[model samples]
Target: MSEGEYRVAVRALCDFTAREGDLDHRFTPAPSAREGIAGHALVAGRRGEGYEAELPLSGRFAGLVVGGRADGYDPAANRLEEVKTHRGDLSRMAANQRALHWAQVRVYGALLCAERGLEGVTLALVYLEITTGRETLLTERASAAELTAFFEAQCRRFLAWAGQEAEHRLRRDAALRELAFPHAAFRPGQRELAEGVYKAAATGRCLLSQAPTGIGKTLGTLFPMLAAMPRRGLDRLAFLTMKTPGRRLALDTLAV
Candidate 1:
């Protein structure tokens, strides 16, 4: 592992690597966000006292940190489940969708097994139909080795991107930490505006500075923002402008 590493959630991993073809909303048939939360609660309530809901699980794969919450788990039964709430016929779901769901649970199974020091585990996908109030389950038993392999395969798919992201973040942080004011001296009002921006960024707040045009506003804003980026742990900086001329001026100042 390098000094800097990429962290990813299990859901993100499945969403990033397991997805295929165009995004199709028709086969999903998932419930609304609010309804989905309620559905999960209802299902958790129905389970036995041994049932664990919203179980947090995490594991490290290569240089990436993968973590997420499992919907339900039963230690005594050695079962880990991913609950999905839907509104329509699940049979209409795309093969890739089902594969993606299974991939997520399998990774969760691996995480649980590693965390609990188990040799094997059961992976289950519990689908609830909102309209019919029916539950359908698909279960698979996987040995620890199989689960680990599945987790590694998924991580391997994202390893290149994760590495690049980590490298970019490192370079950005290094540059930000060493950045200095561009010009020899700040304009009359530029110092105040730049100071406000730096303080706002450092404290994680918003800043609205009102200044007349052509007072070195662009360089003043950019200098302090770049200088504060490392301190604030910012991943990206966006300078939004209203006009094409403003964009050109901002870029031109940056070139200085």
Candidate 2:
């Protein structure tokens, strides 16, 4: 689907890819970046208190596991902080920001509570401007019970979404499998092409194919894809034939 038509989750994937690119350009260990972050904060707010950054626990898959990186967790302060970089003014701290930032921090807070002995943890969203270096800090508190309930809800939502995706895929697979090229036996390399197409479709990929005559190309490809529907969520595909006779042929071929 087009980018504009994509779901928010899909867009998030795109956003993540962009961030990965940024990390690639200047990849620095969280530990190494501590001084840098503190320095940036200092530059952003000369009047602010001393800025200190640390990488308590780092994992490449931490966000996927717990939701997002708990950039800084202060067991002493009973709070967590996430650093974000934005282009525009950093003075604006809004409500949506509060909820979203809290959700993320709760993830960290929950982790800290689980790993450490903290009962509850507060979260901070430290937004900093790229051009001006100005910064703003927004903090929200979340209890252990609150985080647990919220995370469970998140899991339910994710599962529901996954179920829908699976259903969509199954329907497409069924469509491909049930479609027939309107021929009896495989011709030349048609069997291989059909097999390849089926494999690609099953894995949810787009393919460009050229089939030779008498190979039952439509039937070969479609049948496999259709058959995979139950397992891979493959369902439907468009079958367009230029000739009126070809459409009839396609229908007849599937009968075999």
Please provide TM-scores, in order, for all candidate models, with all chains considered together. 0.84, 0.49
Candidate that scores best on lDDT: 1
Clashing pairs in 1: none
**Worst 10 contiguous positions by lDDT, candidate 1:** 21-30
Per-residue alpha-carbon lDDT of candidate 2 for residues 35-113, written as tens digits (9 for 90 to 100): 4465445543543333334434311121233233355555456657776665544334344444455555555555556
Q: Write the per-residue lDDT of candidate 1 for residues 106-147, one digit (tens) a residue.
A: 999999989989999988999988777789989999999999
lDDT of 2: 0.55
Runs of candidate 2 with Cα error greater than 4 angstroms are 1-68, 91-94, 160-188, 196-256
- The number of clashing residue pairs in each candidate reads 0, 20
Best by TM-score: 1
Error of 1 at 245 (Å): 6.9
